[model samples]
Target: MTRSPVLELRGLSRRYGQTTVLNDIDVTIPEGSFTALLGASGCGKSTTLRIMAGLDRPSEGEVLLSGKDVSQKTTHQRNIAMVFQSYALYPHLTVFQNMALPLTMRHLSSLGRMPFVGAVAPGSSKARNLIAEKVGAAAEVLGLTDLLHRKPSSLSGGQKQRVALGRAMVRDPVLFLLDEPLSNLDARLRVKMRAELVALHRRTGRPFVYVTHDQSEAMAMADQIVVMIGGKVAQAGAPRDLYDRPASRDVATFIGHNAINLFQPADGMPGLHPAADEAVIGLRPEHLSPAATGALEANLETAEYLGSEIILALRSERGTEIRAIAPGDYAIPAPGSPVRLGFEPTRLHLFDEQTGKRLEVAS
Candidate 1:
């Protein structure tokens, strides 16, 4: 039997005046699963996250957590934690103070929160001790045990992010929302933190809704990916599923895990009509080859030398351009030389000319 989703967005949408920011969005996030909201800027990914966080309200829909509607609840009432791309750490607060804030507020009374009153308030010492224990454990897990006393300004970018994450962890939330959390880091640090963040998720066993515009980041980190465009959901699935079998020409071009080449039947390829009529032909660069005897004719345009492979650009007889990836050691023709390109009949993809949606054919 399949497990129920931990969270659900039912008929979610957001609109302003005549413009719709989000169009009938529906999503379900599984328990302990990492789901990425992937899209370009202004695709409403950040707006969707805000709706879930109660920072923004949906015009028509419910945000449900564990089957209960939390749409009307405040951010604190929803028991969710959020980490922003800015790291949002208080510069004056020590790592320990920042990470301990949530627990202290939850356990201490009003008087117990007063700077001096808290030192003398009854039972305040016990709450402080408990907060310390929680903060220490979180710091250890985040590899910040040695720097827990440092302020955010004194820390590195990755360190500040960890503190922000540490603050969220101490809350022990049921769900965590991250909005472009790694976007501010340098490329090298970003790669290292990606692995660390995934490990952190596994260690905590909490559900995550990560929002990012970077396709590579989503592909590398998310267990599931939701592709959004124009405030509407385009597709949601495992990273490889979207990569290998895109549902539309837009998805094909977007997943773009590799260079995707499109062609027309008029280019002289054989066995393609089932997928070519009023449909755009889709091909991965790896699926194309330069052969001695083939149906299609093209002129070599450019060859980019990647370490392990050569990416060749070509233009067909009808001026239809396509790209191909060849082995680094493969003999390459001159830029203007005429060439033959071949592809496996079974590997072609077809999409509707009008809708840009993928087409299916029976074997």
Candidate 2:
């Protein structure tokens, strides 16, 4: 049996006076799952996160948590936590203090909150001790225990990132929102953090709503991905599902490493359709292999040698350029050499050239 979504966006929309930033977006985030909203900049991905976090109000829609309307709720009232790209830690505070700020603000009031005076006053000390225990547990989970006494400035980028994550984790919110939290880290560190985050999510068993423009990040970390384009959701599905069975040519090209090729059906072609004058063809680089003899031929333009694989860029007689990835150590064809290319018909994707929508082809 299917369970209700932990978080839901119903007809969510946002507009900035004359321009619409997000348009009637709807999505369901399952409990204890990771959902990524991915797209290029200004596609309203960030706006969607803000709406769910109650940091920004939707122009016309409702935000729901466990089927309860939360559009009218404020950020603090929604039990949502966000880790920002900048790692927004307090400069003057130690790691311990930084993580404890949320708890402190929740229990303590202004002016009467000196650490020494607050320590012994009524239930303040007991509350602080409880918060410290929770913070320490979160830090340990994030591998930040050793840096608890250190200031944010002393930590490395990765460590700072962990601290930011710890800060959010301490809240134990129903939903966790991360906005490009790893974007500021180096490539190697970003990759490492992705694995850590996946492990953390599994350990915590809380729903995660991650917003990122990096397709690779979204592909690697999310159980479900929502692709946004021009303020609307283009598609939503698992990474492989989106890659293999794209609903449209736009989605096919966006999520893959190589751009999909488009071809016009030739006259007298056996399988050509009268309505299919033009068709979009999607072939991944790995799908292209050197052919000894085939119905298709192209002139090798250039070859790029990666440590593990070689990529070939070739242009066909029809001016359609394609890419092929092969073992790098193998001999590569000379530039300008005419080469035969072959592909299984079943591997090819066909989409309506006019509408850019996928077409069902018989096996």
Candidate 3:
């Protein structure tokens, strides 16, 4: 069966007065897929989310939900739910009430919401019971059934986040747009929440468009990652694809650990075969080994022990510095000692220094 895209942004752009915050951006979020908009601050990821949520008007372009244009729809008409960085729960309301608010607003009137009369009003009892059932189910899924009576202020950070998720889930949204939902949590909690989010997406089988500046969050949660820079998409692909085969130096440096070793290629230096305009060579730390088998050798500058691994900072004879991580059990070469460095020919990444674009190396 052919699946339609859950969300699509066609020529999407946002402008504030004289400045353009998001340029003509176009993207397709696949159905039931968890896609992340990954970028640093001020890169327009949040603006893009607002546009998707119908909270912000775009200067150009349209937002399509299930192949229909929702750009002109109001926030309430979109049927899309958002979980913000701040939980945004009502301070006075208990978790149960908070989760039930959306349903109550949809089904009950002002006169029907009063305490004594509300319970007896025609159809109010049935509606209230239905809302209660939905809220209870959502709470169970979020593991918040135990904290149903607690107010937002009384619950811990992670618990409050579960309440927020439960609230959004109760709405039965077609799409979930999360804007750094885990940003307010502590480091360990953030990791825990990341796993929960992945599991939640799997359980719901819903399309989730998540926005976050944290690369680790994107790497760990997203099935597809859209890397943004200067209000435009720098690159978008699978996390492992982006890590192993970056399209540019910007992408390579931004997505992974270990600073890449960049060097100008001389006239055919052994395995250092150069591509067109290939002045820079990029190699991951694991690609560089101390074994004397490949094309280069460098003198060890220093080594730092990191429990399970050791980071070696080395300087090539021609002044190209590289960092390599080896197993902690491996004997680290002493500083100032010359050691041979080996790299797989296919593992070598060539880049055009001027443009920082990846160059295809000939096999």
lDDT of each: 0.86, 0.83, 0.85
Q: Please give, for residues 219-250, the per-residue lDDT of candidate 2 as tens digits.
A: 99998999998999989998988988888877
Sorted by lDDT, highest first, which candidate order results? Answer: 1, 3, 2
Structural RMSD, model 1: 1.8
Q: By summed lDDT, which 10 consecutive residues of candidate 1 come out lowest?
A: 268-277
Model 3 per-residue lDDT at 359: 80
Q: Give the root-mean-square deviation of each candidate in angstroms.
A: 1.8, 2.5, 2.2
- Extract clashing residue pairs from model 3: none
Shift of residue 298 alpha carbon in model 1, Å: 1.2
TM-score of candidate 1 relative to the true fold: 0.95
Candidate 3, poorest ten consecutive residues by summed lDDT = 267-276
How would you encode candidate 3's per-residue C-alpha lDDT over 88-157 as one tens digit per residue? 9999999999999989988887767988888888889889989999999999898898888888998999
Index of the highest-lDDT prediction: 1
Clashing pairs for predicted structure model 1, backbone only: none
lDDT of 1 at 319: 79
Order the candidates by TM-score, highest first — what do you get? 1, 3, 2
Model 1 C-alpha lDDT versus the unseen true structure: 0.86
Model 1, range 1-363, lDDT digits (tens) per residue? 175788899999899888999999999999889999999899999999999888898999888988998888987788789999898998788989988888887889989999997899999999888989999999999999999888889999999999999999997998899999999999999999999989989998998999998888999999899999889999999999898778888778787667688765566444345556456788888888777775567799999888799898988667778788778887888899987877786677787777888888554
Q: Model 2: what TM-score?
A: 0.92
